[model samples]
Target: MKRRNFLQQTAMAGASLFTAGQSAAATPVYQQPADNPFNLNYAMHDGMFRNSAGADIIDQIKFAYDHGFRSIEDNGMMSRTPELQKKIGDTLQKLGMNMGVFVITSDNWHWKTSLTTGKQEWIDKMMTDCKTAVDVAKRCGAKWMTVVPGNFERSLSFEYQTANVIAALRKASAVLEPHGLVMVLEMLSDNPDLFLRHSDQAYMICKAVNSPACKMLFDMYHMQRNEGDIINNIDKSWEEIGYLQIGDNPGRKEPGTGEMNYKNIFKHIHEKGYKGILGMEHGISQKGQEGEQALIKAYRDADNFL
Candidate 1:
């Protein structure tokens, strides 16, 4: 069947399920199954469905929930005001939705001088960020924050750089461990200067850190670009992976619009018993409300493998 036809049929089926006498205003704008639809806990970020949900971040979150999304992530969450963060937390708690990752950053740190430099000032700045992240996490009910080790130090040897990063992460881990929060290390494929670029590299760092609070973030889009053999590498890095993000290659848009087969990937993760969130960290393939509907349909199709 055509994608649009399938979506139209599903929408009609969902609309038919509404209770008698319930006005359209009383029903969720996005017609979805009464229960959370997807088998896996796939999370959407803020503004993903803005065309349908309007401008409010909280409304966007509630819109995602109405479409059967059980979790949400915000990379710039730390930059939000504390009052807004608490409201987000309260809203998620009330809706029984889970919060995913936010990036860990501080004013003193730069991408170039990150953990790879091994400089005390940089490490100290990271520690300060970790302390602040704890409070942010508490307010927003986030368990994991993305941590990038930053660009490589050209003057430093590979072993020295790795050691420096491990030492820095260990320190940050100590502060986060007590709070039951985790800092997930992400490997970037966008730049050659990036210190961490492979799953094995992140797995090694996580092993060396040897702290529960220090784990790797397996971003499927980056990994697909960095290494083509996705499933095998996932198994190898499974033990240390704390979070996952999703995007498709070639265009970095919704799954079906790209080359990666998300259905099989999701099935593999589900069979492996992963209860963690897989963040939908990509842009829509289409535009406006049509794009939002298409995005949800794409996930629904991919998640129907069960």
Candidate 2:
């Protein structure tokens, strides 16, 4: 099957998890930022896919840059060829765009294994993988890498699992700290059956790791699904949140398409002086290049309220 078809199917399977809610507070009619002062950045995975039209990846980078996104995130960045990585890094640097989080964990596929297993072999492998990820980050000048602690260990006690995750992260932090790399633990919402499903959980994990190299990747859509208090939860966990991601709840589409007032959220984060990228890890509501252009327009429109 084509890659897009596969992704659509994957999204559909995860769609039912979101319970419907009120549409985002009516765009909060307001004036725009002076020449757009919001410092928001968007992830490139879906947006680039929509705009590229099978264009070369470099052209895809140009497409996103022209569209007003100041950043990009690739979950599969580690899998890209070294040459491709260098090329993307060079292009992004030239455009003055930031490289956002890429995956550093082993459980990226349809598997279940927590990094907190506390197994010597697992810990060693993770450190080795993170060391490699650090090299990629160095080349791309990326600061954040996504780290999913993996699925719940049913065989172990919850306390044991937490301890294991903490130990593993402590070891992982050792690898990233010296290089000024951060591992942002993403609290995924798709698998509620697994661990790390809420902002509080992520906050606790960050606190436990207790290192600048360990922080939270607050994915807004996921957090909205896992817990509804968007603003309050952010306030509570602000200190540990190292990165932010965007996708509205219900549809997991562009911001305005669902129940998220991305404008106010952007305004809040911007006003708070969050310098990190807001990864646009979402899908376009429409199809193909038209949808891609629409996504850009939607960001411009929503961000105008800033």
Candidate 3:
């Protein structure tokens, strides 16, 4: 497994959590000063810091950078105009920040003719999207994009479905391999109807696909719900894990709000030398700038492990 080390990514926003009885409309705007970054790269999403940065997207990026966040993820990047994408890329470059995953394809959370069907139409659709993903990657300077192979086809057997997904991924991998891009498969725990809901399943799929461009995106929140042994599961799928995401289970909010011990989890990943972007994939537990500040401090509390 390729391992990279990061400093703790939270803190200094610790003050943002407290607002004694302040209403959402009356909450005071808080400024986040750059503090020491965490050992690992915890990338903030656009809306995560909107309270501190206002409604402007570009301001959100600067606010995140102003704090300690050096990476950002935007799942909606594909929907953005090319001009906006370039502006974001340029801004990130100016700040020397890294780009993280955006979705290439997503399931409608319903039964559809997915890759699992071994349907030519589904495969063709995926191939078309793969080509588009390459162009988006280039424009945004992003290396990782999310790929969800839709829901399971009730008519198909599991083995046959697996084979179809693997075949489709190989074709997609070819499109990404030349450009040094990766498509990290996300395992969702939101629905049982979805295929690829487990970490081991993603690991097996990556192995079968056998391409560096095809890797696992271990989302801690989903995995915590699907499989509880977070550390062991991470170690099990380490090699295929090209990216990571953050969210406490139960509430799907920031760390420490739920049953999952994010402090230990963050420390474990850091000490193990797993170097990758950990996307802040959840919402803030509190409201307003206070919520955002708590989000930052929550990371600080969790990443304290050596």
- For all candidates, the clash counts are 0, 1, 9
lDDT agreement with native, every candidate: 0.83, 0.74, 0.79
| lDDT digits (tens) for residues 139-190 of candidate 3 | 8889999888778888888898899899999998998999999999989876
Instruction: For each candidate, give its TM-score against the true structure.
Output: 0.90, 0.85, 0.88
lDDT winner: 1
Residue-level lDDT of model 1, residues 105-195, one tens digit each, is 7642435657898999888888999999999999999999989888889899999999999999999999999999999998877768889
Higher lDDT: candidate 2 or 3? 3
Scored against the true structure, residue 165 in model 1 reaches a CA lDDT of: 96
TM-score computed on alpha carbons, candidate 1: 0.90
Q: CA lDDT of 215 in candidate 3?
A: 98
Tens digits of per-residue lDDT, candidate 2, 95-189, equal 88889988886445213565656677777778888889988997776889988777777888888989998998998899999999999988877
- Which ranges in model 2 have alpha carbons more than 4 Å from their true place? 1-39, 46-53, 107-111
Judge candidate 2 at residue 47 and give its lDDT.
Answer: 28
